[model samples]
Target: MHKEEIVLLHLTLFHIKRLFEQAGIANGHFKLYDSLDVQPVHIHKSKADHKKAILMLCKGITEVFKETPPDEVLRNPKMKELLEVVG
Candidate 1:
């Protein structure tokens, strides 16, 4: 996808993260994303950087909805590894 599209997606996810936080549903799952120090408004960032931020945000989202089924939660093994690497 184009860089602009990726940035837009990143922005949407960022807002969702904020909403989750305000609603007290957010946990510490955003640690990796916070470590990246990239925000949706940072349009100058590279496409790859935004992509990584998107992944981290998505990971955090998945984490918040703790009611997800076990099999589904275990599907993204790469995400677990990525979190470990970032941690």
Candidate 2:
């Protein structure tokens, strides 16, 4: 994907993460992401940095889903694969 595309994806996922947090559905799953101090709006950041942030966000999102409904999370093989690859 192009840099702009990745940034857009990063923005979307960042919003999803914030929504989960606001709804009290997310725990400290985003610790790694938070520690990175790189927001999606930071276009000055390198592509690789954004990529790392994206993975951390995905990991956190998967964890949040798993925490709320373990059975449902297991049903999605791809999500599990992503969690394994990202975590």
Candidate 3:
């Protein structure tokens, strides 16, 4: 994807992240999906876990938003896989 496309997706992901936080999902992992365990049994989760968890969270949220209409974001199909990674 192009730089502009990435930026747009990032903006959408950020909005959904704020919404999730407001909804009471505070693990500090939503910003680092692949790094976070995203489980309640993990008592020794590290910063790396948190990072991966956030990435996964954002990727999922971005996909869901892409399928739905945009209220505060521009949904698009071309950006779904762009963010579904551990990077």
Candidate 4:
């Protein structure tokens, strides 16, 4: 991944973490493993359902951009392209 993309991903994850904390969801963690080279971003939540954890993270992401139109984020070229594959 390019430096800018990595930066954006980190920023997004940071906001997600904050949102999770605000929602009282403890131990919500995200990690990016560049070495994996596939599905590098992982969300961790102890004693939680994997699918539920992902939903919570996605909710957190939505809350983070609550003031902004979500389309604006998906419109990001790099994000758009990435989402096309992973989303």
Q: What overall lDDT goes with each candidate model?
A: 0.81, 0.83, 0.47, 0.44
Q: Estimate, for each residue in 1-87, the C-alpha lDDT of model 1 and write its tens digit.
A: 999999999999998787556544566879999999999999999999999999999999888776545455435465445435546
RMSD of each: 10.8, 8.5, 12.3, 12.8
Which segments of candidate 1 are over 4 A away from where they belong?
A: 67-87
Worst 10 residues of 2 by lDDT: 73-82
Q: Which stretches of candidate 3 lie over 4 Å from their true place?
A: 31-87
Error of 3 at 10 (Å): 0.6
lDDT (Cα) of model 1: 0.81
Q: Which ten residues in a row have the lowest lDDT in candidate 1?
A: 67-76
Q: Which candidate would rank higher by TM-score, 2 or 4? A: 2
Tens-place lDDT digits, model 2, residues 5-30: 99999998998787666555677999
Relative to the unseen true structure, what is the C-alpha lDDT of residue 40 in candidate 4, on a scale of 0 to 100? 15
The deviation in Å at residue 75 for candidate 2 is 18
Q: Candidate 4 on 16-82: residue-level lDDT in tens?
A: 4544444443232333222222221333322233333444455555554674455665565655565
Task: Please report the candidate that would top TM-score against the real structure.
Answer: 2
lDDT of 1 at 71: 55
| Candidate 4 C-alpha error for residue 7, in Å | 0.6
TM-score of each: 0.75, 0.78, 0.37, 0.32
Q: Native-vs-model 4 lDDT?
A: 0.44
Q: Residue 34 in candidate 2 has what lDDT?
A: 99
Of 1 and 3, the candidate ahead on lDDT is: 1
The CA lDDT at 12 in model 4 is: 62
